[model samples]
Target: MLYHGPMAVYNELIGQGSLKEDDFQRTIIETLQDLHDRLMKYNPEPIVRDGKVAPEKERGFFSKLSKVFNKKEEERLAKEAEVARRAAIPKGLYLYGSVGTGKTMLMDLFYSSLERTDKKRVHFHNFMLQLHGRLHKLKTTTHQHEDPIPFLADSLAMESRILCLDEFQVTDIADAMLLRRLLEELVVVRGVVLVTTSNRHPTELYKNGIQRESFLPGIGVLEENCIVKCLDGGIDYRREKKTFFHSAKPKDRSKLASSSTMPTIVQDSSTILPDTLVDEKRFFWPLGPDTKKEIEMYFKSIRNGFQVTERRMNFLGRELVLPHTAGPIAMCSFDELCAKSLSAADYLTLAESFKVLILTGIPKLKPTTLHRNETRRLITLIDALYESQVKLICSADGPISEIFGGGSGAHSIDEDPSTMGQLTPAQRQMMDDLGLNDVSQVKKSPIFSGEEEKFAVQRAESRLIEMQGPGWGM
Candidate 1:
């Protein structure tokens, strides 16, 4: 019996009783197992290790001549195998489900089981950013007139024949339009396979938006090229822990002053206290048991002016240098933290690095202003902080509900020119790379503007409210 790939791993995990069994997950695993078997049969080089050709025996001249002919025959056989493998294109899988349905987990298992080297797994957003960058380069440099989609697809195929994309979504209209052509070229032309996970079904993607009709072709291509599997499960395993972090009710100012320790000044006047001291009152808010008045009094107790040493740390393959970090607390501007291409992994790193984080200047995430990337990053950051039990103190433009409002109106980029002006250089570069010529045309229709994102923002908003509760950080 030849058991390989995800099924084997699944079986092993089952035997160990490490994972609970799910019918949907098992179906996906079985499908992946079948694909793995076919890939092994067609692309035998990955499954079988070939030994070095044996040294020619020092015999007669005929023996030496035979070795040369044998070498040529072997080369021909290898070429034939390569051609056969290329002909056997694998049908990719697209797993879709609600949040925490084990789509990412299953995809990861399948990805790990693959033996091929020409495979890659990436977040869909990051992948799009890269694709746009490549497209921009192509447009500027070598191929101005030629269709760039096919070229980009061909380039991607060359780099990664099997692309395992997570959290696949088509939010931006530009991305939606490009995705159709890119998918068609990759699947129909280049024979590159795609295994992706999304919260919505193919038909439901890009649901309602300006010029959404143009995006339907991409949906058709996805349906034709990939096997769409829905992972059915109800429980959000991540939410099992109700109290992941401490919380406390607001207390009297006098009580707060007595209970909280005064900041101790080090011998060096420039050196701030190691734990949870904020230099700027405007940048920090004392949530939970500590009131603003209490915090101010504590600061006044420390006679010497204080400064914190900046430090740098690496997380998720990105270098983050903090301007202020002492003991278990760090502070930075919201844009400085989130304006760049930071992922959940970077947020996780921040959570691990600090007990409390003081973020300043969080703008309202209104539909009108529609700082999509920045808003998304904030949501991810909050999720990370909440899960990791990190306390958050921050200044925002408005209350949670007002900032992350729920409405059905379309979010136009042109609604707030001032907000657009505030976009970091990196954000501007991304827009430029994506060839976003007209903001008016890129309106996010109420229907197709991503319910998942809205839900995520709502969750983040709820978390923010919870963090401010008297019980928070207790």
Candidate 2:
């Protein structure tokens, strides 16, 4: 008999037919494994790493924090401070690419394989919300003049030696402004290693924002510290076959919800099929009562309809109500998700509250005139789910490609070589060399009214199609 040990790496899962092997994914996984090994035996020497904020304060909170992270220098010279720092405190990994390029899967696999209980993984938006909440609480309770960041960093560093943050995008001005300071405090002052994933490159982050120049330093800091690598799997990994490992237990009903519009998964383990194995399409088109009925039937067939109603969620001093939710599943309408004043934080909360979201009535969202705000909100909501690996069930007005209102480019995930037929071979080669995710990243002029919104729709389109893949949600 073949000795099959416990699955750890992507290649192992690939050998078991549960994962598709990709070189890019393998490269990142190797880095993660290395990081894991180092962290298992590594202990940070008590010394402050150099940061932008080299305070001159000699006493009190700053002094205490300085003491906690302080290291002895060879001399007063800055060169000596640089030389005296301990053998690199294990650089963290930052993986970014187009949607459904196996970034999250790789991160999850790495996270699962880690034996360290000190490690914590979180979606970036939710993590920032938590930080903001902590900051706020400290501000209200602590000394007015005292800075909260030092205390916070010490607390966080104590909690986790390694922080694995997922879906690292810089959209919020508050987050953008605060990011560098917070990172300096954590990574430099207190020594918390960061493993992050993103769709946007660090340099491309917060592009075309109000006072964007201010955000540049944070991006620089991110690039300088983290080993930023792009994992472009060429094709959306979602389209691959979903398989159950006989070695592992069967996935919950929610994981079976690979797509919001997926075929109803047969409950019996033996009969369960991957996306390619089934003839039925994931999305329902040309909305009607029959479509609604079909969706309801799926709800019932999957796990009998909603087990509870109006599940209240409180986070960051806000209460969000999930209208109809069963265990690991929630049924939500377009209006509830997109039409309201829901922030990215709220969507993240919703994603965490349930493993599967049944999203209904997805009308055609245009970059130009129609439902721009709704389009933006829906895009954000999809991101939250996609990043969190939540299974999304979408009932829509159109196909995934055409969802952003039919235009010259239907937001085809730019990874497909056939999509760029017009580009010369050398130009394509240059693009590949440069690691451009898609045509959307290359546009010189706005194709529609909103350049940013246009980019967002393209990303959303990519994610929606990727979510339909059999390999998703699992």
Judge candidate 2 against the unseen true structure and give its global Cα lDDT, from 0 to 1.
0.65
Question: Which ten-residue region of model 1 has the weakest summed lDDT?
Answer: 248-257
The true-versus-predicted C-alpha distance at residue 161 of model 2, in Å, is: 1.8
TM-score of 2: 0.71
Give a tens-digit lDDT track for model 1, residues 241-281. 33111211011111121112222232233333333333323
Model 2 alpha-carbon drift over 4 Å, by segment: 1-8, 45-82, 241-282, 302-329, 387-390, 407-455, 469-474
What root-mean-square deviation over C-alphas does model 1 reach? 12.3
Model 1 CA deviation exceeding 4 Å by range: 42-87, 242-308, 311-322, 325-374, 380-444, 447-452, 458-474
Q: Please give, for residues 79-150, the per-residue lDDT of candidate 2 as tens digits.
A: 665545434567788899875576766666666666676778777767888888888887888635687777
Q: Tell me the lDDT of candidate 1.
A: 0.62
Error of 2 at 192 (Å): 1.7
TM-score of 1: 0.57
Candidate 2, residue 163: CA error in Å? 1.3
